[model samples]
Target: MIDSQSNNNHFISESGYLSSILRAPVYEVVQITPLQKMEKISLRFNNIILAKREDMQPVHSFKLRGAYSMISQLSIEEKKRGIVTASAGNHGQGVAFSAKKLGIKSLIVMPVVTTKIKIDAVHRMGGETYLFGSNFDESNKKAIEIAKKNNYIFIPPFDHPSIIAGQGTIAMELLQQDAHIDRIFVPVGGGGLVAGIIVFIKQLMPHIQVIGVEAEDSACLKAALLKGKPVSLSCVGLFAEGVAVKKIGLETFRLCKKYLDDIITVNNDSICSAIKDLFEDVRAISEPSGALALAGMKKYICKKKIKGEKLAHIVSGANVNFHSLRYISERCELGEKQEILLAVMIPEKKGSFLDFCKKIGKKIITELSYRYFHKENACILIGISLANRLNEKKKIIDNLIINKYKVIDLSKDEMAKLHIRYMIGGYPSKNILERLFSFEFPESPLALLKFLKNVSTYWNISLFHYRNYGTDYGRVLTAFHTTKNSPKFEECLNNLGYRFHEETNNPAFCFFLKK
Candidate 1:
């Protein structure tokens, strides 16, 4: 079995960082499985596409390989104390799995925002858990403090040497499995996986290109390169929460500077689109972070005209929440196709709708949200989808011109949507007033206060809309009286309060299904 001895004596000056990673238990090279059709369409580089299936590793992701190796390096004394970590997602599960096998006490601290699915997964693997913090950063901070106070061994997600060593073993597996590799695209978060893989490959193969794939919303590498130092991002997009890191780890970043070829950032829409493609082609439910490599590669191929190149994207994980499928479906179209948002003013007459439909024709309608303002003026917001690599959206715009139709494509103009869409809906009047609530809103009633804060200054509400299910929208519905003098809905409810009525035979409330 490989250990610290091989690492110590192998390469002190030139390869010490890489040597620590080479001795991981996952020594076998991940098989370089060639996808037949994909390789034939060669890019700017050489062909013979190789998919190094690190996803096939224990725990179903490459995390185990690193976590196991990192934990293994602990001294006998340290091992006796066991380990603690903070990960509501993959890292928590990985550490737990590793600790369980090693017969160590594993404690995982997760953020309260963590999904039930992940929490249950950690528990199933025999890891004790503590839920704390509102976000990952908060949870991580608490975990660090706990480790220091309790004297529990702190197993970091990607910053530790043992972890990096275990992760690097994937590179060993890749080289040993197939020596002929052109490029490897790995999903990146804190740079652990990419750093480990790159260090090993460059030390051994030196010729292979190791690219890092990161979410466009939180591109630590791109920001770091631009700034000439690591900087924390103000905010990051949440769709690919797994890899949405504000900053890269110190140790991983140091190695990445030397080994990684370059880092590519892809947006949530693109990552979601890649997830759909992977699901359809491989029947694999890849998480957003996991599918990032494929999305980046596709974007790169289109932009750089990169052909004749052997490409492999990491299908990193499958621990996807079932509820997120709707999000995946929504963004998939936007990712694959350049979106065109238009507000068309058509006559409210009978044949006007049909006339506009005729102008739209074959282009797919990705989104359709409508508003009826006046009897003569009804507006329909349309999101038209166009292929990024192939279709020209201007053709559709040109058709609208020839047919004497008004058009405003907001796809390329985000500022237009941010500042204009709300104003575009209707003239600010009593008719436009809405009592909006959403389940996604934080539990604090600040939005309600904001609404009340603005009241009596402008116009009074004539109609208020509220439903119990408005939790999805977050604007709770109180009883709204349409007549003037503006009755206070809340006061009446407070006075009379709630009424309890039971009707076993009530048709609306019946649970029985009719045949």
Candidate 2:
């Protein structure tokens, strides 16, 4: 037997086994994918920018490199019985796709609430899925049970030597492409990717720096490093769902602690802004987690005033849902964050709602959504577009505070968005309603079915109430975005026997087409 550990090529190292982790007892091996030099990013400070496009993998993610590498090195018997894993989506898809490619059965356990697109992608990749648990922690527990009960190999998404070594290949390739690289930015989740890269790079050249980037809401590595121990978070925010891990893996933490130079945490707005940059500048679609590294790199280099550096950003994957793009689009400018909430109050009569909009909307109107039911009071929910300047945004809210609109800032709060917002109506209205679900139209018609929480969708309704009450009839109001592209909706309304108000013209119609 040969010593297959990294960094000791000294005496009697198994030249072959040590070289290819695949042959090593508990490690996986991945061949380095070529790196593409992006000259545009390089033009700054004589620094060269190279992007490792891991998104092109067979599973459309770097997870493939780890999954395939790890599975191939497993015991032959383990291979025969196949493998199983738990994932929010990406890792499961990678393992399942790898298993299928290698002619083995595979199982993927995922949270029940995972989006349909991700679920479909896993199925399309030939993974048998077990939708279990409300979240990743529970799904992971279920995977362990299934693995033990069925005597199958448990292929973790991360946190194992084989997986980490496989991920290390990215570092190998990066060095090969730019050996003199000064720094590499990696997105952190369970920390496997960053840990592997740091390990491999450190073993070769201890001088180069490796930075781990994470969503601020889920900076497990940062917290662990700062505390000098791995501590699970009580709660996690999920804007960057890809890297929204509350806990770091044992092996991953150890390796990262040994080799990683620094870890950076970025806000959801910054990550979303980075996503938009990738989309607009590079014609690439990156999930919030994937873009974290790039965003961090951009921020890190600037903050440190370090120029003339060679930087590598791992462009991890692009399995984002199409409907998610709406939010990405809506918030790319807003940095994908808003103080969203619902409000209700007794109508005092005459222009009260407009007063609220005028008070709030005069400065910002990112997205306004509301519906009214007839009664003494009205309820409305909206996502406020906060100003980039905190003080100015606070001013708008301060005004609301003085006016007493019963404003609630849900951007910093998720519990409100999930539970309280829907409760805006009276107990009678809220309890009496069978359901209240809100989702947006996709870029196309199929989008409704694709992204809508339920098949049944109310028409695009934007109903609000004013203080003024008409004696004969209530002024039924609605809003629609019309332009060269609104004819489709207009034709549908025409076929449905609804016409716009003649006075308003141009497809501006209220209930029953203003009849």
Candidate 3:
């Protein structure tokens, strides 16, 4: 066992975390998860890629380590009072499982939009459940209030000393599992997991690089690093609900800033791709937030052009909602850059489609959408598969342009991917002055009703598109028919409390939907 008193390091001495982590009773409830080698990803990246299987824990997440550690250390009086916590999913399950093991009661407060799978898991683990708020932050406030009212001890998901030490136990097992690791990639939510890992790794194995990964839309850690403080984000993406934290915890930010080697942020597409990668390589279905570290590690290796180095990332959890797989399957190819979407202008005549196909050669067509829209010309949206993404895509586009066909790349267009492709048909018959906008709001029946009530009362809706991906947020593409060029419509949207982006001038909308 590592002794804190024998260590001369100032950080270890001041924090006393090395001893606390070593003495933590997390192993009683949590197992030493395996460090598995990712054979397929390793071969592709030309690096030794390993994954820490935190998803194998009883709660299907690393959260149990911290939850059990903190709860086990509670005084006798505190234990009798019970414990309360707000979680998106995994942490609540951990607390519930731990409390059951200790013969104590636990109350788990979750967001209204949380997946039924997680809520059910908590209940199965013996936790009394209360659904409240729309996201973690709001739920956390309610949990605190409930704890105060009921005289229960509040258990925070992150941001406490005992919790940090419990999570640090992973780093202890990691070094023991592999001695030649060049870098360790950890996912960041409120920064607890990454902070704990960094504190332990930097204090002991100072040479091994410790990197933090975060979802691009929920990158509170990166935002904090820039501003030199734990500033709150206005909104965070809910696709990766586990790590969709609006602000980094105060204690976590301090450790991350002081010892972390670097921070990397990944988009939702990359996260989807990473989930596919893990499933293909390890037969593990990881949640979006769970695969965040692998996505960041892949981006880092590609950016640095590093080869033959040993890299490892945490597979944090596997409690994904079953309905989310459809969205992930649709986006994984795009994230890998192995697929591209294009809008091509073809003459409105027979043999034009065949000629276009021949011009692009024998490449695989993943999707094609066409309709007779005009007498002179027609627009067709196409999806093509590419082995060499960058070069092949360029060649296909250049060949079409050389053949006198107007080609617009819709591969990177958000509107095209999320709405336009599915709703492709024809534009309005009359030349209507329409304003197109994309909006996102919390996913709930009440929230949707509230959104419609507010927007429909103010403007005449011309086009609307929405699909539920079993995520916490609802995405909608809508058009309002209006002759006024005033700021009143935008002002109304702002007051509606939904995130909106103007897509009226977007190329996809202009080519396919505008009259």
Candidate 4:
């Protein structure tokens, strides 16, 4: 436990962050969001689960608190000069709304892939918006340039002291709402929110744990902690666009590294599952980043086998892109382990389908994709709904194996989930050296056209499939007719700049698409 008096004195003397947070005038435009009990989640996990509803704020996010706190403290000259900032989405909306409230001009530079919903929100709040770059880091560089050129004050999204202090106000409200809380799970992006909460909570309630959750693909805070410094990631996942920062801020990382208890990273699937949980229990449609803390909390509880503890998580925002719901719904069942996908090779004969169904018994078949290949055997992609995932999946695979049918568990295959399931079709008529690849490119109006032009110009594209799941990046599965020693092809792909993986030998590809 910390010495409350000494710790408080040390923080106040060193930085006065505690005092700044206490005196923050965020309440002028920010809401004192509710601490809501998640009844269904509580019962399911055998714990008292509470969610701080920051999604209820004016911008539908807690970001406005920090944005307002920093902007409201600016000098008359600074305010007159206006402000410029970079954001993925939510923070831009927060800054736009706050600047409008104070009758100051604001410029928000966001990544080109930012959802239209957020872009429109910024415009509605009277902020001039500029779409730039592919992600936050790139847009951040642009914002700094804009600020300097215009002689406007650059308001950082999470790095500044005022921003951290403003975010720390959430911690003050949390303690007042539930003094008996055992743990607080905060979502980490640039580390502002988690750093703010950790500093305040560790000093005031040292016994209570503060854990930071991050999306695995964009885990800047976790990466920074491991490296002992704030490091920029080569690439970040865009699924949770709000928290897709490539690097943790300097000051925020220092505080988080010192006071944060642990870091948990969850995948997009688990985040989707958490979103579904929030919607079911609270009737709130949370953005992927908003449900991130709950996803990590669920993971932590399962890993520790802890029960009956009072756990709280921040529902940080609800600025969800409507089109993204389709992706979330598709992944949520898999995330919760309520469904399993399999590639089963069965005899291509009459009654084979009936026998397979009989073997599956009462389990619901959610999806079935099959195409005629040869007469001897056929590969089929199947999705089965289940109650107990591990045991049921094992039993199903075992039964299929006992029947002398080859089965491949594709439940965790990214290519299978994203492309193979939909592209089950006959192979080429003539045998050719086909190499398969999966590519991810930034989503935009002309991204597909550019990708097609770049890829098809050099190589003969034997197979191609592209789909938009309302994410910042588009997933494309394409195949090229090339020999194994095509060094030139590899060199060209290197120059292409998009992130890609070779899936030539993938089992799903072999079963479903290979000649």
Task: Give the residue spans of candidate 1 off by over 4 A.
Answer: 1-14, 27-50, 338-341, 362-371, 383-389, 412-515
lDDT of 1 by residue, 31-147 (tens): 333232233223323454444454555555777777777676677777788788888588888888878877889889987657777889888877888989655667788888887
Clashing pairs in 4: none
Which run of 10 residues does model 4 get worst, by summed lDDT?
A: 1-10
User: Cα lDDT for residue 152, model 4?
Assistant: 85
Could you say which candidate leads in lDDT? 3
Tens-digit per-residue lDDT, 426-499, candidate 2:
33322211212222111222423432222214333322221111111112222332333443554444333211
TM-score of each model, in listed order = 0.77, 0.65, 0.96, 0.96
lDDT of 3 by residue, 296-394 (tens): 999999988979999999999999988999999999999999999999999998898888888877889999999888999999999999999659989
Model 2 alpha-carbon miss at residue 452, Å: 20
What C-alpha lDDT, on a 0 to 100 scale, does residue 454 get in candidate 1? 42
What are the root-mean-square deviations of the candidates from the true structure over C-alphas?
Answer: 10.3, 13.6, 3.3, 3.7
Which should have the higher TM-score, number 2 or number 4?
A: 4
**Model 3 lDDT, residue 16, Cα:** 84
- In model 4, where do residues sit more than 4 Å from their true spots? 1-15
Report the lDDT of model 2 for residue 451.
26
Query: Candidate 4 residues 1-515, lDDT tens each?
Result: 11111111233322477777888899999888999999999998999999999999999999998899888888778889989999988889889999999999999999888778778899999999999987788899999999889898888888877788889999999999999999999999988898788878887788999999999999999888889998999888888877888889887888888889988999988999999999999999999999999999999999989898999999999998888899899999999988899999899999998898898899999999988788999888999998886598788889989989899999888888889888898599899999989999787778777877776887899998998898778898899998778768888887777889999999999988898
Q: Model 1: how far is 123 from its true place, Å?
A: 0.6
Q: How many pairs in model 3 have backbone atoms within 3 A of each other, for residues 3 or more apart or on separate chains, i.e. clashes?
A: 0
